[model samples]
Target: MMIGLHSAPFLAMVAFVVATLVRGMAIRRATGDRPWAFASAKGVQRIAGSSFALCVAALLVAAALAPANGTNLAVLAAIVSLAGAAIVIVAQMQMGRAWRVGVREGDAPLFVSHGLFRFSRNPIFVGMMLVGLSAAIVSDTWWSWSALVLFVLSCIVQVRIEEAHLEASFGDAYRAFCRQVPRWLGLARSA
Candidate 1:
């Protein structure tokens, strides 16, 4: 059966929204803080999160509804998504205390540079990108691809904002870490 966007995309969209909202809320509740700062440079984090959710949804829709002919693209996307998820989970686990949805100015309960963090500065984002890409590939639609692009853009902007906040909070420590680690990508030694 040839699945199309009409049916699958909507379901994916719903799932994405629910997942993000639930996750965001959990993060908020766990951290006891909001993720957004109203006075700051707008709501980049919110926007980015929203964009990522939408893109992921679209990709999921495509994957489910589209026929599985075992295309190379779909296979690759699946691998990427699975790998990314694993990496992100490891990173999240390592960053137990420091894992908050929004920025925190004070000293983080923990400064994790272990596990996946030792490899990639932003393993979560990398995982997210892989998931987003997988969705696009699974969907095999222009819209899915577009979502991938938007997701990347959102991550880029959000990362910069996050970096500024982290630098302010961590000062030289963060600067030194940045010097050692790449922003989105990871080096071989750590991986």
Candidate 2:
């Protein structure tokens, strides 16, 4: 039986741990009127955002501990996801202390149109999705796919909620940024 720390499942688990640590650091460094992110998300955003955590846990357990079915492609995907997460960290750093987990109601800190934000209106979400997708790929299991679906669903719901908040907060300036930047990537194609 192939079972050990050197297995593919272990790689997935390690990736999850590293990504979570990095993400946690980013969240820890966040600043703003964070009266909700730690307390609660607020309405539908609450449920969607909460699912994100559950999905992560599910991915870690199912993907990281599943039978070592991961292939070279899975390893490559894992590398890509880790790299994406690192980029997301850099992007978050660009946001400085203005980052928060969920949409903060009544808090309009900055529109942040520079750095990676210039590439995508929500680069953080894109990176996060990549990370989740990597987890799913490495896991090579139905549970991991389920987690990915949930992650995507959660991301979609949260993005909508956040856009509404941004539109209300930054008004026309944010609208302009949205027009200039794509929702995900490929800024040139987007334009």
Candidate 3:
């Protein structure tokens, strides 16, 4: 069996995860607030968010352990993975101090509508989904593909939960934004 542990693509995935965690920590420190608030999520929201995290871990493990296909498609997948990482970083930076891993209750952060937000309501989620998809594509393992499917489902549920919270917090403003921007990346529908 070929080992992907020493592969450049695997290392890049690891680096992306580490960089994201570091940025999350920095955002928490700078804001002096708990940005990793998934613990506060209850019911389905918590389950969905937790599932997304678990799927991400599964993808990481699969990426490290599974042999890459070494096909042109794999190379394309690697490029997509890098682009996803870039998207995550850019979206997080655009969010700045308001960047959060989970919903922070009792406090409504800024209604961000600039940069990537202009195109997608949840660019970070889009980026993460891309990463998961790329991981499955490159790994070419049954379990990795299954994990990607699960990740997408969980991500969708989690996004819906967050949207509900935003709507409740921001009311008409959030609704208006939703009207102007699609949930995923695309040109805005007639609004």
Candidate 4:
């Protein structure tokens, strides 16, 4: 069993890149006419894009160098990727017009408190992180984890900036919503 670049890791990386690019371009088309709140948001999006590129590059390198082993890690990685994909789909369905990457002011879609949003404020980011982590796990490379960590941190910063912009635009409504929802991981209901 020759475990190398042609194995599961490389395929997973390619799938992730294709999915991300397709989704991102769709989002750009969806929100192209909106009035964004901050110009820096575009820069942040570009940084995120670059970080994803780095993640794919690292995954490819790891795949190329991975030792031949029939460990269960590959199976776990596939499960995680599938789970992440499901989460992304659910979040996207719930978001509808609110499924944007940047901050917009003009009578934007109302805040959604149902579906995935009821659990985590940023389900899409969570899903993306899960996918990245799964890729790292599959590659069995420390550098893959580093890329995932950097991508997650970048997302956190972007989320904070987005939250501020939303609060400014949506006023108390946004604040109250934030108070109720967890920033990252979804928590159980308090009932």
Candidate 5:
């Protein structure tokens, strides 16, 4: 049975997945290098990345299985999810060739601190969290909420790893940028 076919949550999740895949494909086509690194990760990175990917899948499953609700709240959540998906694509584009799924050994992309990065050091992750939150809201299911929580936790671990890599690679420049931009999003400090 095609349950929850018309649910906004399911639609939003689909949209986010489509946007991410399309953008990733475009980036890969533009550059010869593969942008994906989940499969190549090891140790903690491997665990976190795999966990995040699984959470995304769990959210998709939960959304599809949840009961359909066409309330205004669902529509709002869909809109928010769409915005989040857009943010992911836009931030990725802003990073341009610098965008990557995970850290690569000796693969030093440019230190991006403009566009969406100026507002949030981790805009891509922020957008992902938005998608997870919206999926939970639209689905209104225990499974969806649990998936969202796991998604957030996984992101936290992954972000810390990426941040450390950036700091080591970019040194003072990365630290200065971190000081100017909040981890997520907020008013920039004047200093």
Candidate 6:
């Protein structure tokens, strides 16, 4: 088990899970007085996206351990995943308590477009995408490819839902931010 931990796909999955757990704890602690500050972004879209992501993670593990997988790429995958994990950490830190798992409703009025949020509307999700890509590279299997495909498709839907929510919730402010910042990264067109 200890040796298996070094496998790239497993490590990537673990890193993603651990980072999320830490973020959850941070959210709980930060929201001690104002619990409504956080919420489940849960919705039909989110549920479907989350299901695909979970499936990918599970399938990647099995693929990574299979005999066809090689060690040479594992280290590279591990490095990429670590970098992605680092991004997740930074994004979560920036959000602090502002991070919610899904679209928030009622009361919370803050729109964060500073820090890493300025670079990417969904930094955490971007980082997770990196993690998924790393898993695919490490496993180099059809299963892992399926996982990556599912994750990418999920992100497309998730982003649409989230952007719609942000637009509705923050109105002009969010639209301005949208104009200012590219959805993933790079410079946004000026409004």
Best by TM-score: 3
Over 4 Å off in model 3, which ranges? 1-9
TM per model?
Answer: 0.74, 0.80, 0.90, 0.73, 0.89, 0.80
Residue by residue across 29-76, what tens digits does model 5's lDDT show? 988767777668899999998999899999888767665666776777
* Global CA lDDT computed for model 1: 0.63
Model 6 agreement with the true structure over 1-191: per-residue lDDT tens digits = 33442365566567667776767776668676242222344556657556655865564575357343347676677677777778877887787666666555563446677788878888888887787877777666787777688777777777787788778878898888888888887765666
The sequence of per-residue lDDT tens digits that candidate 4 reaches over residues 1-191 is 66542255555555655654566567668777342333334566567656655765765676555565556886776667666666776786676666655664454566677888887888877876776666677666678778778877777776876677777778888877887888886663563
lDDT of 2 by residue, 2-57 (tens): 65322443454455456545655765555324423634666797789789878867
Which residue pairs come into collision in candidate 3?
none
Q: Ten consecutive residues with minimal summed lDDT in candidate 1?
A: 4-13
TM-score-better candidate, 3 vs 4: 3
For model 3, give the 10-residue run with minimal summed lDDT. Answer: 3-12
Q: How accurate is candidate 3 locally (lDDT)?
A: 0.79
User: Total backbone clashes of model 5?
Assistant: 0
Q: What is the C-alpha RMSD of each candidate to the true structure, in Å?
A: 4.8, 3.7, 2.5, 4.1, 2.4, 3.4
Model 6: CA > 4 A from native: 1-6, 33-43, 59-72, 107-109, 188-191
The better candidate by TM-score, 4 or 6, is 6
Error of 2 at 46 (Å): 1.0
Candidate 2 at 183: error in angstroms? 0.9
Global CA lDDT computed for model 6: 0.69
What TM-score does candidate 5 reach? 0.89
